[model samples]
Target: MLELRKINKSFGSRKIITDLDLQIEQGSILCIVGPSGGGKTTILRMLAGLESIDSGEVLLSGQPFDPTNLKEQEQVVGVVFQDFQLFPHLNVFENITLAPKLSLKQDKAVYTKNAEELAQRLGLANLLNHYPYQLSGGQKQRVAIARAMAMNPKVLAYDEPTSALDPGLSQQVADLILEMKQAGMTQIVVTHDLDFAKRIADQLYQVTPVE
Candidate 1:
């Protein structure tokens, strides 16, 4: 389980999250839903090691989780940004394998196989040669997901996954998330779409910005 204990965050004098506590069970999907600027994405960023909390602690499986520890964070959590940040210069295959190739430093064949399997599972097998700009929004989003999954993190978090997709595509994403959950990957989703949250989350958390 992942637990946030008395978490507090602020930017200058403006507080964002204050005295917040949350627990995320393993192999479960937890959706954080709220209005704009409610610090939902900030929580994901903290998990991704992109942001820092002013006070409190993050614990994963009863062990201390240090957000400043890049290596530890990389192994524990994977994040999919709202913008689906794919490398414009690299093709789908390259984009998906680049991180593992650089970070894992294992046999190229191992990471290659993992990337291929992820692409196939996410329905990007045919688009391996395609660039981000060449694919549609949904395809790009899938590629982003595949890239994150390639790292095989224990927890995956997404920020506004369905913001750019229509209802049909949103449902498809929801299904994919559920499939991941069945595979024992714990997920945290930050979205404003309550309907999408209801469709996918095993638990719902409502966050409001601290004034």
Candidate 2:
């Protein structure tokens, strides 16, 4: 399980999250919803080790997790940023396999095989050669998701998952999230879309900005 205990965060004089706690079990989906700038993305970043916590503890299973430890953190948490953060310089396949290729140091054929399977599952098999700019918003999101899944981490986090897509495409993303959870992947999502949160989340957290 992933748990945050009495977490506090501040940027300069402005506080974001204070005395906040969350828990997500393996194979469950946790969606966090709130108003804009309510620190939802900050929470996701802190969970992914992209941001530091001011105080409190982040634990994986029952052990403490150190945000300063990149190598250990990457082994457990994978994040899909709100903007879909795909590499502009690399094609889809390259983007998806980049981390695994570097970390696993396996033969090209091995990671390529795994990437192909993941792309097929995420409906991106046909777009392997396409660049991010060449694809639509929804396609880029799927590519981002595939890239994250390729890491095979214990936890997956998405920030504002449906913000950039049309309503139709947003539903597709919701379905994809549910499919991933049903396949036994733990997920943590931050979004303002309550309906989308209802569709996929096993647990939902409401966050209010600390005044």
Candidate 3:
């Protein structure tokens, strides 16, 4: 469903990705395991159009990646960063519903029903009105997942998804991920957690060490 052909990106004199090439299948989970600063997040940013590719291309299905037209990419991908970028002031209901409500611009009642359904699936039904500060680390991360699901994305990219959580909570997140896997969500996760990766990924690509 996605292809990265000789995709290269750099910051001035330092190159992070050099002739990196990959093809990801639909409905498969992939793990990208490597050292810090090994161009993992750079790959995600490039795919998400948060950062530009220096050379080569990232194609969704068969078309080239376009930075300007996000609406064109809406149904194709989603992502979860390590920091769990939830809005601090917004309640969980607001944070989770923000993207879909803004992008889809559906009626409040319809969006609310959709948001509530996702929240319930992710075990956040009772916490919708709670703010970020009111949630535990796991709660925040689940809210992040629910937010992504709210967008109805088919391809999900998870960057070190469980890195900041404690052992118990990390496993909780992994369990949630596994549920998604069983439901046929295509995911690419960049993580150092081998056991967790093995539990979820259908394939593994160890990012090569940079010289």
Candidate 4:
């Protein structure tokens, strides 16, 4: 389980999240939806250990790690950016394996097998040698998903996954989220797309600004 208790965050003097609390069971999908600047992304950033938590705690299972320490949470969760941030110079296979190899220090053979399996599952098996520039928007998004899965993290978070896709593509993304859950991957999705959220979310969190 993942739990965020009374979490608070700020950027300089501007507070982003205050007194926020959330709980997500393993293998479930949770969608955080609200207007822009409601600190949705900040919540994900804190989960990914990319932002500092000002107060409260973030827990995985029953373990709490320092939110400011990337090393503490690096292997516990993975993130997929909205832009499908694949490396421009690396091919699909390379991009997917890079983090696992570098961050986790997994052997090349290990990450190679992992990447190939994720690519096949995500329908990118044939695009292994293709670079980001050659992929369509949907394909790029799939590649991003594959990249995140390669880390074998217990939880995955996506930022505005449907922002660049048409309705049909958005539905596909929702289907993939369900597939991930069936495969026992916990998910935290931050999006303004209500229809997409309704299609996949097992739990929906509406985040409003804290005064």
Candidate 5:
């Protein structure tokens, strides 16, 4: 469903990703594992269209995908940053429902249902009305996941989904990832946690510096 062909990204004298190539099959969960400064998150950023590719291309569903086009890219992908980017003032449901309502112009019913359903699915049913400040670290991350899932995109790109949470919460998040995979949510998770990646990813793609 997704393909990255010879993707190249650089910063000044430092080239983060050089001639990197990857193919993510439809309905498959892929995990990218690498140490810090190894260009793991850089790859995800490029995939999400947040960063432009200096060369090559990212293809989705056989079409050459360009992240530079925001509208087109937003329609096809939902991304969860390592830092939960939820609105501090908005309640959990509101945080999850905002994107669909504002960006997609989805009906109120659709937004409500999507938020409620994902909240329940992500074990955030009881925290719907809670503000980000009121929630614990784990709850906040789940809110972030729920917000990402609420978009119902073709692919969910997770960048360090569990890096901040405690072990127990990370396990919970891992279990939720398993459920998402079972339900056939095509995902690409960029994480340093190899064990977590192994538990969730159907295939693993390890990125490294080219000698």
Candidate 6:
């Protein structure tokens, strides 16, 4: 389980998240939805170790979670950005395996096997040699997901996952998220689409901007 206790965050003089509390069960999908500037993405960033919280505690499985610890954070959580940030120069296979190679320093064979499995599961096996520029939006999204899964993190978070997709693609993403849950992966999604949230969320959180 992941728990946030009275979390607070700010930027300069403005408050972003104030006294926020949340809980996510293992192998469950949590969807965060709210208006713009409400700190939904900020919450995901904190979980992904990309943002710092000003106060309170983040705990995973009853232990404190430190966002500042890069190695620990990378092993515990992964994030898929809204823009699907795949490298233009790297082919799909390279992009998926890069993090494990750089961060974990795993042997080439181990990472290769993991990458291939993730690609096959995500339906990107046939496009392993293709660059980001050559792929469609949904394919790029899958590649991003495959890359994150390669790290073997227990928790995965996404920011605005369906913002650029058509309804069919959005449903595909919903199905994939469900499949991940069945595979024992916890997921947190920050999105503006209420319908999408309703379709996949095991629990829903609404973030309101701090005054």
TM-score to native of every candidate shown: 0.96, 0.95, 0.92, 0.94, 0.93, 0.96
Clashes of each: 0, 0, 0, 0, 0, 0
Of the candidates numbered 1 and 3, which has the greater TM-score value? 1
Instruction: Give candidate 2 regions above 4 Å deviation.
Output: none
Q: Give each model's whole-structure lDDT.
A: 0.89, 0.88, 0.83, 0.87, 0.84, 0.90
Q: How many Å off is the CA of 14 in candidate 2?
A: 1.6
**lDDT by residue (tens digit), candidate 2, 1-211:** 9999999999999999989988899899999999987999998888877789999998988999776576732667788888998989999999999988888675799889999999899888899999999999999998998888887788989999888888788888888888988899999999998988998889999987666
Q: Which candidate, 3 or 6, would have the higher lDDT against the true structure?
A: 6
Model 4: CA > 4 A from native: 70-73, 209-211
In the predicted model 3, the residue pairs found to clash are none
Report each candidate's C-alpha RMSD, comma-separated, in the order given.
1.3, 1.5, 1.7, 1.6, 1.8, 1.3
Best by lDDT: 6
lDDT tens digits, residues 25-65, model 5? 88889999978888898888877767788999888888986
lDDT of 6 by residue, 126-171 (tens): 9999999999999999999999888888799999999977767999
Candidate 4 overall lDDT versus native? 0.87
After superposition, candidate 1 runs with Cα above 4 Å error: none
Residue-wise C-alpha lDDT for candidate 3, range 1-211, written one tens digit per residue: 7888988888889888989888888878888888777877778777777788888977877888664347742756688878989999999999988887888776899889999998888899999999999999889988988888888886888889888788877778778888888888888898877888888778888776556
Model 1 gets an lDDT of 0.89
Residue-by-residue lDDT tens digits, candidate 1, 55-146: 99999899997877857226778888899999999999999998888887647899878988998888999999999999999998999998
lDDT of 1 at 189: 98
